[model samples]
Target: MGAVSKEPTRFTVEANASGAARYALGDRADFADVERGLIARFDEIKNERGETVLDASTFSFIRQGEDAPAGVDASLWRQSQLVIQLGLYKVVDHLFQVRGNGANLTIVDAPEGLVVIDCMEGVEMAAQAMRLFREHVNDKPVVAVIYTHTHFDHYGGVKAVVDEADVESGEVALVGPGTVESFNKYALGENVIVGNAMSRRASYTFEALIPHGVSGAVTQGIGPGGGSHFTTTYIAPNDSITATGETRTFGGWEFEFLYAPDTEAPEEMHIWIPAINAVTCAENANHTMHNIQTLRGARTRDARNFARYLDETLVRWGDRVEVHFGPHTWPVWGNANVVAFLESQRDLYKYMHDQTLRLANQGYHPIEIAEMVQLPDAIGKKWFNRYYHGSLHHNVRAVFAKELGTWDGDPASIWPLPPAENARRYVSLLGRDAILAEGTRAISEGDYRWAVQILHHLVFADPADAQAKELQADAYEQLGYQQEAPQWRGIFLTAAQELREGAATEGGLNTASSETILAMPMDQLFDFAAIHVVGERAADVDLRIGIVVNDTDERWTAWVRDGVMNARPQESQNVQATITGPKQAVVAVLLDPSRAGDLVSSGVLTIDGDESVLASYGSVLEDFDPHFNLVTP
Candidate 1:
């Protein structure tokens, strides 16, 4: 036969059922908490053009009280049922939240007006969420906006709720963790260097192209499936919480911030509202086990730091925190329950960190360590600590990588052949017929992981081999069906889709915004330009350029030599060219040198000396192809 069928195989069905049995699926307390305090529900949320931004009805296929279909993990299906509860909920006497929009938009009643925490992922979603809040809850003016972290979902919708003029005029305070420079550096510059590669990978991680149904995406672990497509906007923060125990009174509410860096994000903080006995741990603590290293890719989070922050939160405010909410998932009520929740989450990460290091000390490789470590039942059995977002398998590997780097101490394995060449050699050595037979047999034996690995070489060796592609896709689908973590599920399923169909034609999540780019500091902007320079193209190019920003009164010297670009503050003697202009015009010409003539002619830029230097440098800059291939060579 060509391959196993597209439908969930008997092996997949049994695997999913067995996984579901491990959880207390019949316990309906989580369901009660999800539906509690619902003030009103939106029929659906849409953008200006009437395109749907979010529609809970789309997930109606997931029956509330029924067992999960074979295509989805049973535990995940139950979580999705709770996630699809879309509405404005009253968290307490003064706090309200808008859910089912990827990130939670919380509104807190302050003395002057409303204090908003987080603004969803984009303009439309935040706008719709704010509209619902105004319609159902209090319609007070928003006096302050607080961003819990640097992630887009936490603060990208800034413009939807607050005006830039107001922030500039000091009419509203925009508060964030760390200094303004640090926030801007991470928020705007973190991904600009390797954005294209990360974006393409994110398509698989978030199931960006997967349809919402029983057989497709169900949830993104923290919330419903399908990433947003609205306009993502940003505004720089006016006030910074630089240290833990930093206090800022926004509209009469005493907000205590815990500056948590390098946890879920590079710059993040948790909010403790003392007057209300409520705390929002930002994205640090959530309903599910959060990513120690996100599937899409980022610097590995310090699991020790993650556990430390949770423990600190518990020690500082465990007795006083009556209710706990976050940017994602439902809140935990009751001080005792909240404390217990924090302890479990804290222990979960601590165990992962300690155990992984223990095994590493015993001379185990990351792969071997991943297979060895297991969560103890005391914390592992809790619903909050379940592997809905992050799993023990990948997380243990992340901890290993964090401590011991990528190398496994084998010099022979260190310098390996490129993927395509290696795959070709493997196929040639094994023989195509033997590899295919083994793959099929592995699939028949419910060894989808092994099947994918063996068949992957065949597909990579010969991209047009339809038989290999189909067999690999079948294996991936079975693996996808059995994943409890949605990120793993998304990756496996999207891989299967790519194998069966082809690489995605369009790009994935793009975080670069005009506001963000413009806000980039001069040094960072030059750093961004350096990464864009192609080494081979710039090898023969030699130029020293001087730059002056009139508005910012900044001076810099940049030069290209020996296939690399370098820059420093202050002007250099004997520079070939000096370009003087406002920061915007200078940035535009630097990004796209073809616009130099128009800008100079329009009096936006003043070019002195050899004008051709700009052209010479620009020629070496390369624009990234967003839709790069992933599964295939």
Candidate 2:
């Protein structure tokens, strides 16, 4: 493999006055000021199909795909401009949008040898960034990549960052949490049971298509508020470390890895650079409060664990840290400032966790606490006040799920009817007209919280109610404008825009890579299944089997224990089937469902037992829960 450290690619960084002004506020996104500005801006806008116009002057970027050139749509172009500029931090102008992880990018400063953290969604963007990073040394090379967590935004594209020959022949070092095999589950259940709504819901949540000002805009999107969509691949860690105080050096940089698994992600960790006084918390700590439950849905994150991870990070590196950069937003420089930022992040989750549990102890249901959850003046005043990923409403559900479980304590809610059935019954009890009238009144009175609840019933009761849809859209529109969290702002605004218009047909959404999948082991993949697979599907079939990969002499068993799918490595057993093939080959086919058939045809797949079971097994699993409401009563 030609994984040589080349002469560094040289590049320059210049200040973008517009980006400087907007992001310079650091994390203090003033909601009152933001809201008023947006309301006035909204009056001048139009919801044109897929485009939600941002600022015209700033909404332009280098077009790299089949989509229209930047600025064809003011919103998309400007957002792309913002996404590209803000995400890259203007660190590399030559290196533009890669695997679009919004602001997330993977740059290899050759002089530094290799320093990549989170490859956005596009390979080209990563490639561009690599070039920019290389420019510094003129001949240095990328030696290692650090995937902070298993989330797609964290690391999705590898081919663009490193050559394939280097990955296969062992030229680069891949680092992250969980076993190397845990990351693949991100793309596993794509076909047969597609979460088409995820990209839709993602667009709804990210508001990538919306205008940036008040009415149409909100905080940015989530993760890196990531952009681009590309196939992902990962190089297995040439070295592995999975605990606190784990330090290792690659190329010239020293990394101290802190395992933050089970907090933000099932398999996640943070890296600290003692030399630069920089700490990459990955997805653990971000500008705004992250989702306890994401829209491209998975199981709710543990609030206590989420806060605890931040606390641990501060304890370990609070003194040495000079700058605090994350998967998103501007970095906080100075020891005192960094401590303050991390403390706010920690307290935000801590308060949510402590307060929510306190409410739950008071016998409050998920809905009650979510509606009531608020921060004191200190915490609420921070720039991260916006609910981007982990909105206030849904995080309460996550809190309840943690303390009381998803059962909601009420027996009736335990075995709920189909939404349509409940909708019909509820509408029957209260005439549709009354609900609509009440919803309208709530909207006028600025009781948006009430309007959301009332209109929800109207839409569910009569999915065809135009007025209800319009008013709901209006309410969501207002909420979106008011939100300061990037993801929340994007989601609320996107939803409002959609209801007012129609479902925005997304441009092109990217997929992940096999390298990234191989980095994930079967066990982590199966765990991912537990999170993404819909409960309704699991309730039907009961399947237990073991898989033995002949190529590696590896045996894995998957069972329905306690109504949950569990899989782990074990001695080979004469159970269901022993599939034979290279793990990467099998993974490539498994990455996308519709592509599963390619395995059999390519002769890479060989099943011994019921061949039909593979189809059934795939069918039984569901895609990510995309339509979940981030802001609900």
Candidate 3:
């Protein structure tokens, strides 16, 4: 569609994509026959302002009818075509899924009313998904909403399908495992500290910054990429599913939930509908490999536990599972196919973990292990097992980082110089011309990895170097064009764009969204506030402030010591100042110091001792610029 790259495409990439397509042809049945029964396709979803939330037409540039473009991988293009097929598809009897509407929203027909699982992302998309669901299927009020996990994609659009009034009046039951706590912690907590970094990195991870085309963003590897631009909202769950083998019949449908926490998400679970002989694997077993530690930073997932959970799914519900679906991809039919899918997924994680550990035991570092570990035929050869979302390189290192820390136990590697310093030193030692000469040679020889590494040092050493930056961007473009994983391509391309043009003017989640701020517990709020306290600024200042919220009787003591801020539930014994206020007032002042005037004026705030102690403590708190430079700084 765009000016395609002239660089030679690798034979391995073509072979890999061809192999994947052939495997799919052999192993998969007719997916289109299942799609034909869809009631309707609502591709155009718009917001109140008439802005497209999930534009199905954005991906129309890459037509399914056309052959794979020169720069794009054929298998990935095929997956892209599958992901972009926006419609309501019938999974089985009484079960329907509105796929390609951002996230897959599955509608289950119950006797009393309709039950919906996984509410896309925003009100716009969710409402459209619900509308699509109602059009093909029978129109019934949503009696219950089931969230398989704590992720926002599974539950954020709750307000769209059912009213809060219904949920409040007990007409609708909001169900999930660890939904509220997990949502608050991951979605809201400490977002102010790391939100921008995560958002920027996620933009790359999901190809949000790139346009959708053959040479640009194709698919997210799990789904299509047009749903990135949307408002994020969360609706807390009322009914919690705590443990595995938990069975609950809502409106006459018996549903069993299996808790699989710390697998794909921090708090996640899989669902089994015994009545229909169907199972929802949540985000656990998707079309693509799920991330352990996402490119957007998160706590490392336990690979061992992840593998075990998949095995547990097989042992618990494999025999009865005739149809299996997830929040991302198409449904898998037939018991044998479902078993193979689950088993391959199970072994995929197990092999990645075991092999990484085996290599780590032999004193191989993360980089070495990542390069060395390879999936066997049973796991890697299958089309479903292809690394679209997750790859061997990153996942292998993730496993290593989990079992062995980043240290690598090498004394020489312990204290490496920072990037800028090291880059400058390298440039000075080797000479800029010499470095550029070698990088230029690598680029010509199609050794892009080496070219990127060398050119990166030259650019960082002198950000004003036009030739170095240009060459690096070129190298990144070529690598991006060749990458099978969409996220890796997105990251490389975004980096190149930033180098060529400039950093993005706007992007990132609102850390202080009204709902997110209100739902936060006082303790979690305090923990987030602690992160804002600049360690360098508080290094020499020993300030202790005891907070007493008269409204809630919640007491907290926050102190700065050794350049770090620490907070505990109990009040300090020896406090410099005791600040007493209502819970709302205290929270307001804690979040925004400017609100202190309003609280003080209303007689809602009072200081017992030296107010300077509180003032000094507040002064150390730094506001991070969310728009900080990424590639350069």
Candidate 4:
């Protein structure tokens, strides 16, 4: 049977209305800045197959100059309107930005050539952005590309803006925060391990499958949506800015780099332009509160570092800089406005960090701290510091997790039963009908959070319980409707949708970029291989394998013993199997052992040992399921 959905509850409508009344919805400054210095709007962007990658017309449902609908938060609706104003805008002299294509591409018209900062999320969007720039602005060749951070959205479309041949020939320089190895470690390595799980979670956060309408995805907090369906490419940065205050001249423009490690990204930096009196904070300081820990999951960011970096930026150029822009959101023009913006952002993180730790020291649990702590009106009331992307609730929890860990000083919670087992126990104790009755009562009382919590056990206890799923989904929908943060809303709504329709069988965004995989170092590749070995399956197997990469002149000995796989540099004597090939061929075999014979027959790989050993090793390696159930057991 098909799932049934519910409309916004009366209580949810009243809550949203009350929340909307608190914000100055009539404010025009943000709107003015969003549409300021607009050159021309992009009509459409298409990939090679004539598929529309990005089209502003798709978001026509978001009617500008209108009040928030019943299904959306008022504040988030405002952000959605601003982000959906898709066009190439002039930020300041010699600076242009193409906004609303996943990430904004900042262009600098330099004396030598155009210097581009961040090239959207995919090649098609990047190409369209550059095309818009050329059509409305200038058409000078791109002499340099600056990657502000290690995020894929920041540098994925590198090939579209500049030629790899030019980069190789030194005609175009690729500048970034850290060395190529460091970039690969954070960008490629971090995601490749447990990538399927992260991608599954990210689908909810980004609302990848959600339709665009008042009842669906409005904005991706910082932008209209995630990257369009196009080729996501990456090119390692050739030039690394390793230190703070390090200066590099690109396209006749001098840029001072402030290496900000472990803030928004593990490898991230902010650029200071002396000539333009402008600074690009990368993803550090945006129009909204940034994530201390993203919902999609990664290493927890240092809130203290986030604050310190902003403070450093403010102290270093607060008075001098006339404008401040970022990869996401509109620019803050004028010295006073920029300074105020920096101070607010700096305080935003610092306050959250200090307060979260303060509560932690006082022995309050992370959840308790999140509920008790509230931002001062001076900081929270500001439009720039509003919870559009990151919320105080989650950031506070993230800060606590980073410092105090997830234990919360409770013995009972330390080694609790797993979710499904715990749910079954609860069902045995309370009975399913009683739990459902309580959940329905909570929903009727406008306690959606409590309703979802109680219904959670029922759903887990019996996945086929339609009443429990419906009640939980209804509660989730109401909660989603009231979230000011787009990500929070997306998570809740996506969960509700999945609970109603069952989890999607197809995978989310395919982040396994071939270029990124190829750029990965040997250690990372070995590490990835180790993760694929199923411990239980390998318990009885013991094997020694030698891998020799001809192109890189690298040798490694991989041994599987004691239900685990370990690899070290250099070969060991008397290996059971030895595989010699180029890095590409070796990588292909490692990723898909079934293709080993084909690669060997095609002369791409030479195996000089027991061939059956390869099969034994492959037998233990398990491929991760990309479409694993998230909202279900």
Model 4: per-residue Cα lDDT over 386-441, one tens digit each: 88878999999999999888788889999999999999999999999899999999
Instruction: Name the runs in model 1 displaced over 4 angstroms.
Output: 1-5, 598-606
Across 98-202, the per-residue lDDT of candidate 2 in tens digits comes to 222354564434335766777755454455555544453344566777777765655545566776577556677767676654433433333112344455555
Query: How many clashes show up per model?
Result: 0, 74, 0, 0
Name model 2 segments beyond 4 Å from true.
1-84, 87-101, 106-112, 164-169, 181-200, 208-229, 497-633
TM-score of each: 0.96, 0.70, 0.90, 0.97
Q: What is the C-alpha RMSD of each candidate to the true structure, in Å?
A: 2.3, 11.3, 3.4, 1.7
Report the error of model 1 at residue 295, Å.
Answer: 1.0
* Tens digits of per-residue lDDT for model 1, 68-152: 9998898888888888887789998898898866799999988778899999888887888888888876688999999998887
**lDDT for residue 588 in candidate 3, whole number 0-100:** 75
Q: By TM-score, highest first, what's the ranking?
A: 4, 1, 3, 2
Model 3, CA-based lDDT: 0.76
After TM-score superposition, the amount by which residue 196's alpha carbon in candidate 4 deviates from its true location, in angstroms, is: 0.9
- Could you arrange the candidates by lDDT from highest to lowest? 4, 1, 3, 2
Which prediction has more favorable TM-score, 3 or 4? 4
Output the number of the TM-score-best candidate.
4
- Which ranges of candidate 3 are over 4 A from the true structure? 1-36, 165-171, 179-187, 190-193, 508-514, 540-563, 568-588, 598-618
CA lDDT, every prediction? 0.85, 0.57, 0.76, 0.86
lDDT of residue 234 for candidate 4: 79
Name the 10 consecutive residues with the lowest summed lDDT in model 1: 1-10
Number of clashes found in candidate 1: 0
